[model samples]
Target: MVLISLGPLAGDVHLLNRACKGAGTHEDLLTEILIGRSNEEMFLLKEQYRRTHNKDLVQVVRGELSMKTERMFVMALTGTRDESTFVNHQQVQQDVETLYRAGPGKIGTDEIAICGILLQRSDAHLAAIAQAFPQRHRVSLTHMIESEFSGHMKDALLHVSRGAEQDGQGVYRDTQLLEAAMAGMGTKDERLCYRISRYHWNRPRFGAIKNQYQQLYRRSLRQRVEGETSGKYEKALVGIIEQN
Candidate 1:
């Protein structure tokens, strides 16, 4: 695929439309574009999609995806989520209780409810939620997640929780994402590419991400990729990581 320098919103809509084309959808392409975007960016992309294709972006996504993936995309496009905002202690407490009853406090995990709260709130709000959680419940929110869920769901919830917590100007979430891509046996190349592609153009943000990755893992992200992959693929990954 030739990557042209279209404007951000226009480029995103173009990729999304391409992903939705005949046969089966390019799910990795769709996920990489949608999941990497901010709520405000997604809102603009939806409008741009309508102008470009005469169809709703959410409708297009729904037609192409189902279940959790569909829900994630639709929620992203809704643009109701907060980004960086003052913590609402009262609401945070309520959310904590909601999560408690949904997960550790209950027999079965309420995946929908837990994810609903995680997805809608801003990272700052989620940090507040994580802080307040231990006061209400004996375990930390991360602990509860580690205990209550398993497999991909576990990873997703953890991503939501950890992504909410930012240290200084650095994004700790990128460290977690990098770990996820490298965890277990083989590399999750699609996820790795998504994360690198997501921030490669934003020098400061990507720099912070790289810094946090080193802090968390005791090695450079480029080093880890070098150790895990080879040939042109390795070169490409390292190039993206090193790019300004």
Candidate 2:
């Protein structure tokens, strides 16, 4: 259960305030609070932010962030991309075709179409889309993505399209997140916090994520964090991961 200290909603609002208050935008803090929340939770947080701060959350984020990240947070705050639990089969097929033509069938990947459809739809819808994709196109959505896109865009599309199931691919998703966090010269602290904060409270899901991390990487999530970071930050990350 979510701990009720300041109240989850109030705590989220304060986190956002801190994210926007500093000399530079604390993208990590913003990402941790915003990206991990459900659409309904986010809607309530925005409402509470306005109630407490007398300012719109989206507007506040807009002033502090820019470009793609700004657009993503705005969409997330407005609850535009939250998916409904119920699936529409016809719409799923249409989305599959749209995604196909936007990527594999075209000369160049249609980043707009890809992001708009994949990011906006609910996980259930995406699962349905993934299920139907190969039936019509003779190719998996994952394969199509691998063929058409590269780098972070590819990773995001794959992660979103993987649906809510905790299968092998879901495990792979956790590994990818760990790799992203620890990749390159310096740690991507925002990405690390976002992934941990998003699932740390749910013991079962977080356990599965940790299991996947160990199976795929041959190292525990805590070990990875310990190796990549030092002192308080590393302790904080390991604490979050180990939290039930």
Per-model CA lDDT versus the true structure: 0.74, 0.72
Model 1 segments more than 4 A misplaced = 1-37, 51-54, 64-73, 107-112, 143-156, 165-170, 182-187, 228-236
Deviation from truth (RMSD, Å), model 1: 3.9
Candidate with best TM-score: 1
Name the runs in model 2 displaced over 4 angstroms: 1-37, 64-74, 80-86, 102-116, 138-159, 162-175, 188-194, 232-236
lDDT of 1 at 36: 33
Q: Give one digit per residue, the lDDT tens place, for model 1 in 12-68.
A: 677788789999987656755665356778778888899999998888889877776
RMSD of 2: 4.9
Pick out the ten consecutive residues of candidate 2 with the lowest summed lDDT: 162-171
Estimated TM-score per prediction?
Answer: 0.73, 0.67
What would the TM-score be for candidate 2 when compared with the true structure? 0.67
lDDT per residue as tens, model 2, 1-244: 1222455567668768877996987765675466424678877988999999999888998998766556656665666664578988989889989998998889887876777776677767777877888899998888888888765445545666553333523545665766788989999876676566655656787788788888878889888889988887777778878777
